[model samples]
Target: MSEISREILSVGDLNRAIASSLEERFDTVWVSGEISNFKAYDSGHWYFSLKDEEGQIRCVMFRGRNGQVGFMPQSGDLVEVAANLGFYVPRGDIQLTVQSMRRAGMGGLYEAFLKLKAKLAKEGLFDLQNKRPIPTHPRVIGIVTSPQAAALKDVLSTLARRAPHIPIVIYPTLVQGPDAPAGIISALKAAEKENAVDVLLLVRGGGSIEDLWAFNDEQLAYTIAQSPIPIVSGVGHETDVTIADFVADLRAPTPTGAAELAAPRRDQMLQELDAIMQALLQRVGQRVEREAQTLDQLALRLNHALPDPDRMREQISGWQKRLNQAWLVRVENWKRDQGYFQSQLEMLNPQRTLERGYAVILSKEEHAMHAVRNPKELNTKNAFEVRLAEGQVEVEFAKLGLLK
Candidate 1:
């Protein structure tokens, strides 16, 4: 009680002590800020700093909890992060570890967009199974986009150059800003109602976050998921991604890519057709030549055979008579041999010694001769019956006693 002593700590120890104190005092919190200096690790962890106008804080988002954040936060993207104040124990540095996150737009509209996207993905509306395959040879390709958009020209020119035979039916609509969502949705509906094309190209030029908001609309995502015809989304540049990219059957990096993806290249298709045609022609020619060879062989044989037709007929008739006479002589010899065998068969008959279909009664023992008369060793009634080749008869002594 009289003396006071304090242990001098190094920077790490002091930082650990402060972090431990903060952890014990404060619970988890939610923060809103613009993301900057975001970097991901090879271990699939994200390290970033969240900054408001005045202050900034470091953050870490582990891969396991990363899904809680719907879309990736771009540099300078205003975001709402649900996090907890914690200490990085090894370094004893205080940091914000995030659990859930969402983009925070003006009035948090971007946050709402992320929430809706997460919900739709969980419902499997954006699954590959739901995506339709674009027709291999679409008779008509539909373009759902702003006619005024530069992307429209890119799409038309690409399709015209790639597949000149295929016609493009443009379904013009707004491609940016708030009203663009409804306009795009209605254009798709109109295309489906008319069954105007085999597949659709939903395209737009590159833009910033706010400018591309229409492409992230949940209703539009669902519409794409349910569209009967296949859709190829080519919104923004290759680096830009939208909700439509996941819902579409195919995602193109640019508007020109969408057009080229929706139809086949004319030169490649014609080359394939020509190859197949040549193969078919070769097969037909080979078959005709084979038939001609067979006809020639048959004609030569006919020429040789028809030269002495009368003599050939006479020779065939003579051979037929000789074959018949030889057959008659063989039949007579077979009849004579059959008669001799029949006589021998009649002489060996057991029935002839007794009567027609004869029967002989024997003792219970099969080897007992009929001439043996030891009745004491035999039972004639139920145990004994004589079987002939044709029939059987039971002899009754009315006794079943065994041989004594």
Candidate 2:
């Protein structure tokens, strides 16, 4: 053969080489960053990307290892994640394989949310008493619903068509995945924190239980209740209702209805205004029309007069005296009941029982004594006490025997 050389390694040898080289290069590096774009995949693996003010790298922690770190690291959490940088050949992506994760700084907002929610729920601020009533005709409207959601679009579209002049304020939030609860809690807090909005409309499109769980969060439900502002909850589709609905002052079957409830229709309002004006005019016209007839009737009435006097007052006094005598009879019957109660009390008195000659025996432990039926439960020389009607006596002996 001509001078030839082929550098060949088995697939295992290749994988091992790649793995060892990658592990060696990245082994001791510590990265500081905030967790973002986190995703836990099926197949018992976690897939996420970590980023700092600088940049981001996709990272994964296998199920068992990721589970050891306990609480999930949410997006926006500042974290110093420890991991080995490696490449997943199947996807050909160089990713950081995370080993452990912990919260850092403002990243702890999610943790703090859980803590406060637990505390407030324990104190019951989110209780039924704190809930406010939704306005029947809300003049100024506020929205706590997610601005990015399709449900928001549906709401806006419906409002524009049904009631255009009504103003809508949007509060943007994450409506799905791990970051959802904190995002929602933040939005709700922010709406109140800013303090200018009235009659908050909390709306969301319909989805499965998992898709809708963020609104079901007890903290969110409580936030809706504890809000100084009245809330109208519109979540999921028509059939969907969450704890937020129960805790909210009003529940809309759909987000569109929530918009309808919060915004008064221009057409309907004008109609009502017109009706009120008509009603006032009709009443005024009727009164003016009846004025002449009323004057005539008044003159006729003035032409005749009558009065009733002292005899009626005497009759009333006589009835009052009879009523007072009946009340006295009731008092005498109450006194007789007291005497009957005294007799019953005398019958139940313990001294009366003692006079009957029945006696009670007790153990030295002060428990009511039976016939020592369970000899196994007793000890030799156990003390026995006798409780007589007049007094008590104590005695001890080597063994207790029958009365005979």
Go through the candidates in order and give the clash count of each: 0, 4
Task: Report how far residue 195 has shifted in candidate 1, in Å.
Answer: 5.8
What residue runs in model 2 are displaced by over 4 Å at the alpha carbon?
A: 1-130, 297-404
TM-score of each: 0.51, 0.43
User: What residue pairs clash in candidate 1, if any at all?
Assistant: none
Model 2: which ten-residue window has the lowest total lDDT? 364-373
lDDT of each: 0.78, 0.69
Worst 10 residues of 1 by lDDT: 364-373
**Cα RMSDs of all predictions?**
36.2, 26.2
Candidate 1, residue 138: Cα displacement in angstroms equals 2.5
Q: On residues 1-404, what C-alpha lDDT tens digit does candidate 2 reach at each position?
A: 33456667776677667867887876745677777787777777877778866788888889878776645667776676777888776555668877776555423544654565566667765576666766766545666655567888788788777766454556778887778878877888887986756778888888754577677676676666667888888988776656667668888999988888877776786678557656865785576558646755644554453233355445545755675676568557755765675566455444566568965444443222332434464555577765667887876647557896
RMSD of 2: 26.2
